[model samples]
Target: MNTIKRNRKNRLSKLAVVALCTAMLAACGSNTTATTSTDSTAAATNTSQTTAASVQTASLDLSNSKVEYDEDDAYSDWNASEATTIKLNGTTATVEGTGAETKDGSVSITAAGTYVVSGKLDDGQIVVNVADEGVVRLILNGAEIHYSTSSPIYVEEAGKLILSLPEGTNNVVSDGTAYELADASTDEPNAAIFSKDDMTINGTGKLTVEGNYNNGIASKDKLKITGGTFEIHAADDAVMGRDLVAVKDGLFVIDAKGHGIKTTNDTEGEEGLIALEGGTYSIESGEDALHSTGGLLVSGGDLHIAAGDDAIHSEIALLISGGMVDITQSNEGLEAGSITIAGGEVHVVSSDDGVNAASGSSDTDGAAGEMPQEGAAPADMPPADMPPADMPQDGTAPADMGQGGGPRGGGMPGGEGSSNNLLTITGGYLSVDAQGDGLDANGGIAMSGGTVVVNGPTMNGNGSLDYDSTFEMTGGVLIAAGSSGMVQAVSDSSTQAGILMTYPQTQQAGTLIHLEDEAGNAIVTFAPSKDYQAVYISSPDMKKDTAYSLYSGGTSNGTETNGLYDGGNYSGGTKVVSFTAASTITWVNESGVTEASSGFGGRGRGGDRQVESTQS
Candidate 1:
């Protein structure tokens, strides 16, 4: 029998455990304190049936949810016969000039009707200051506005504002390095287009915004975009909304030094929210590509993001029902206090955790590599015969756990403290290539249905999957390959069979790992992005007491089998080795030694044990 044991001498004293428990309790009780906790009592009582039921009940239905905006509402109730037309050319304006006024190469509209704006205004501005309840619409037809010391278009006091770019027109708005405020007592508009009231931009034309000072487009209230083409380059946030940011359909190409799309409203009941229904977005950002303080809901879109921080972030909960998201580069791919993915196609290549569920708000300046404090028992600790320190005796997690925790103060992937924060994947197709933990949750992780493939971290300090509380996979196809030092399995509540095996020798990058049934029908196929010594495979396709074989170095020949895309499209490679699985969950070491016959349960915390390394 091949067994891995942890050294017992490394265990903490009982007093230390008790003290840690007390601290965790205090943190959980405090609303402002940031700490996570583990519910060992609940974990102990978790049966496979109950776990599946919990996942089913918590699944989200986002079919009817869509981003809503009123297109004709801007022109509603207004008489087009009484409309005003303004034409500007090189600081000269030609207009009816009734409810409109021009001064110092700037145009100001004070009435509630349609205004057709056209031509060029160099180093000038368009100010909209209507009545307290007026709605004004500006139709741009081949308009180009630029200002050296202020926003090109500034909405100072409008109830509602709409900027419409008609088809076949090309509109441009630009701002310079410094903004000159209309009054020192008033807030300065620091964007190329700044609106203080509810604003919407829609039409079928192309609009470009260049902001050398702050932002490209900023709205203090709700900002909605229905249909248009946008090219934005900004020194700060490209598109910002303080209250709500909603996008129904658009073609957006953004390059920004700060967040690409962001909302900063953190009010209790009205925190900022971002809802994206349909669009094609290509973003390169210095910070998070999509961020919201309140919550974010994505139903459908095609997003390709390269960000310095998290690609998509929400301070509260983030729900993605449908989308095609490819995060080519990010510190963390997706992060939220609680994350729910019902349906989507997501591909993440991250330097840190691929999908992280932690108890922290989005911080624009925070970088990766800051570990969270482990609030729960360490993996090196011995399994407790009694209820764990922070766990109550009732076998229920604390009520506050659902509300989530704060930051772990920096340590490792699984931070200390109790957390009810959750990572729920009801349905999705997720592929991750990570240099850190592939899937990490400070609290609990539940997956009822999904297809997950992880090419995990090469370093032993992290695992393919790390969670502080419990990981329950009632129904899913999960293939994770990485280092063996921190290898973990789904909790006892899983119904599907799993195999955790360590290769006898190092498997080079692009090596084909194939799992097949006794009759040589392919079950799963993978090609890890990095050198790997261990692999974990689980699926509903695996049957109990079924004999299966794991084969390495096989030729796939570009054929798709078993609904799985080939990890490596191999050709003409001889089989290097094979292992026969004899149990529901099999663990094999590097010496080709089988622990299945010996009834090897799972790895627990204790001390270091010697296992042969695949790396020379």
Candidate 2:
């Protein structure tokens, strides 16, 4: 690992359901007394000192989910005789009866539930009728006509629409003067306020719902903005609908060319889910400020997202835990199949593949998407010390090395598609800036705790594995600073020729070194030497005589200056060893090289570094 570049190492480092029956109901509001006492402390973990758990308080009564109105049964409160008040508040009404009373004196709803359309209108044209699965909440009180053929109110049947707008007034009103009503030949005038079902907007006034025929609040099911203050301008997919859209609290503001909030599902295994538990959202998007393939879970919220393509795309699994997320992208700030942080406070800037979890295809068992990459190795196959031209070519060690293909076994390369699509961090407070692949994952990464600080570009210019297609650091306090090549652990294509993994090497003098592998799982870890090369081992695939141990560097009074040429320095004593699967080593350390510093400077070597692999 590059050994501590903390700040700017080039960047890289970055549902469901529903059916619905009646018995449900229960969803109106009020309980957000407001609480922001954050003290994450980077996911503190110190088990084995138990004794804490006792709290209680429970009371529930939601009056059958209240959302039932009846001001006189509606028809703008039955004021016929030519009908024309325009708008009114208090008595709550809006009337403009025309053309045989607009197709025979409408307004006849006999309980099918979900209504909250408050009143007061001027160029009135309110015609809401769902008659069935109910849900329409259009609160536009007096002062918002902006006529051009009228659209003061309209929701025929797409059901579940929420326009809201009166907690403090002025939700949105440009003093009425601009207007457009289409009909020439399918002119598409469906949204000044349109619905497809599933819309949510909390109040405090000034609700601006601009339209060009689609998506300011188009719904299919799942549009939830917890509070108020939303500004939307859409031509398509700006707060769309099909599955999910979320904002737990709000001051949300959006500008879209397309996909400011999208949800689509038809192929690639049906995807659609988005979550942002609290809110203060700002989005400028051309596509994907928050796109969903099925799975996006941000725990708290305070997002400032920008995307020309993908600021936050989710194919499956993106779980941050607590808030304050800032993402900017030309391509991908955060892609997903698996990008997890146990807590929150993330900042990402990307051009492409920043925090990706790739898996649009690659599947072998059921054969799903195709499959071929998960540990890789087949396709050209090389690495066992060469020499098959019938001996004597020079460069030593051939003649069957230790007997046939000698890295592991039976020619390696079996196929049934194993598994890879993980990007796991046990806690959080992460910071990343990437040009590409900062925290990647073809399927691997596990930081048992958190306080992660990755600065970017860990190699991918040819030196191999940039930004993790499989990178691991079992514990926390990881600082992979710029310029590439920090760590890579790839073994299991079946091995071929790679060894020498010093996890903690030492013996005699001052004492210090540790090893494991017998259920304990931690093999070779040596620290104390500064100035580069703290750990570096290559891999072609080495594995042979299982059963290794050296618990502590043996008392070799031999000055130990060859620990792979000085990187392991060695003055007095440092060693603790253990091994079960005796051979097969593929270690690396370059991007902020670990051990001498980066955590674990003393004792059981801080945090998580484990190994107990066995197979003889």
* Per-model lDDT: 0.65, 0.42
TM-score of each: 0.77, 0.31
Q: Which candidate ranks first by lDDT, i.e. highest?
A: 1
RMSD of each: 11.1, 20.0
The CA lDDT at 1 in model 2 is 12
Cα lDDT tens digits for candidate 1, 302-369: 99999988899876557777889999998889876567777788899887778876543212213333
Candidate 1 local accuracy as lDDT? 0.65
lDDT per residue for candidate 2 within 267-327, as digits (tens), equals 3233455667777888988877887655566778788988887688765556676788888
* lDDT at residue 313 of model 2 (Cα atoms): 71
